[model samples]
Target: METELDIEEESDDAVLGSYEEPVRLVDDAAAEILILWATNQPVVWKQNFFVRQTSLSFSLDACGQIFTIIQSPSAMVKPGVTGAVLWDSGVVLAKFLEHAVDTKRLHLLGKKVVELGSGCGLVGCVAALLGASVILTDLPDRLKLLKKNVDANVGIPVTTRGYVKVLELTWGDELDPHFINPFPDFVVGSDVIYSEDAVVDLLQTLSQLSGSHTTIFLAGELRNEAVLEFFLEAALEEFQIGCIDQKRWHPEYRSCRVALFVLVKKSLSCM
Candidate 1:
């Protein structure tokens, strides 16, 4: 007989698998997820949220990093859609949360960091709290939630630290030209590579905001060969790409592909 723990393990596999392939679950699948998450919400601060959670770099107030989260709104898709972006609160963001960003680990403190498609502003929030000047950004609708989170968290001093702010970042749309003299020192994007068409836009947008001193870290949850191949094609021109780490979450969801790169100049502004 299968125990409840076994059933939950199976459910985790099923949930992770739903990313790469469609799971023909009942019409109430979404509701079930909501209920499960709601039920598990309180347990986050208890003793069980440390096991697989959302894909955000949520800061845990206690000892050791939090290994779990419940950023459900960050993963909600645009109705009936499936694939990497579906429920992908940006796995790269989650990876950042799973892995800690130390101040001396390459001395990233006091630097300017910007995270694109920051579904729930996880990395940016952590970065800001960790002493870096971070801008948490995403699409307009997503930015609304991002703003709410920033407002709720910012200026509140993280035990002794500060908070991050939400910024509007539409792919292919560059920031104002006035701040070009002092561009961000670091740029981060996680679990953002999926669609084939958006590749060009994402790269082009990155190129504009980056400069010679800009160090960019990109994290992607590879869904297929095509997505990875297309991303490399689009991104190689403006940055020197190299893999840094790979950590598995589940069989269905590929381990997050973390790459570190230094931003160079582009020949022309595509944005």
Candidate 2:
């Protein structure tokens, strides 16, 4: 039986610390320019829904172009909600995807991909930009902001080979057939294993969404070692796991505070 755990709320400062990089917004007549410490390049925020003070922008350099993702910092304060802000793990994982493709270690072109707990949709957007059809999923409440970011980044230049769509996915709920009919070639997530209560359900959902041939990539902040260990222990029961070496991460976007892993369902014959 699954049990609920009482998770401590993260303080405002703790939440803001996720983005260790310095950030400043510059005002422009037509749009706001976000200057991120890592990528000194200014990301221009469109005036549509991105003009609010709560909106923040970050960039990912991938597929020979830059992808800008908009996040809502204000949304993070909602009770038990962490999906509104862009976390460092998301950045690390997204950049790792780019590095893997560039190094010919991974192939995503024309493949189907899914992102679990796709907060801010950074990793999924990067996957789409890398030519993979991607579905970005999270809780129903998270879809609003998730879709907003996807719409702003995924098809901007119309040069990507694959497309991206957003959907509501509550971990452990009975998944819609559309999500598993064609088992995704790759499942990616970042900062998803923060709470113990969600670990079991997350593993359950992962098991259902993956096939023997599917590969799962996850990254998380190292703030909670016990929860992460618990997740890994539980996940091993259904999948083969491996830690991705930091050496293989994107050259410029690496972090000691984030850990990345790759998992695959164990073949039934082997099991």
Q: Pick the candidate with the highest TM-score.
A: 2
Regions of candidate 1 where Cα sits further than 4 Å from its true position = 1-70, 73-103, 154-163, 178-181, 246-271
lDDT of 2 by residue, 32-136 (tens): 111121232212322222113355876656767777777788776788888887777888888888888887777888888889999888888888888888989
| Model 2 ranges off by over 4 Å | 1-55, 156-161, 268-271
Assess each prediction's global lDDT (C-alpha) against the native: 0.48, 0.69
Q: Report clash pairs, candidate 2.
A: none
The C-alpha RMSD of each candidate to the native structure, in angstroms, is 15.0, 13.9
Candidate 1, residue 33: CA error in Å?
A: 32
TM-score of the candidate numbered 1? 0.60
Write the residue-wise lDDT of candidate 1 on 1-271 in tens digits.
3111111234322211101211222123234334334543423333212323335334434124342223543354565222212223344443343343431223345666778777655556656655667777776666655665555554444433333556667788757653245787677776667687778888887877776456566655433456656666556554434333223222232322222222333332222
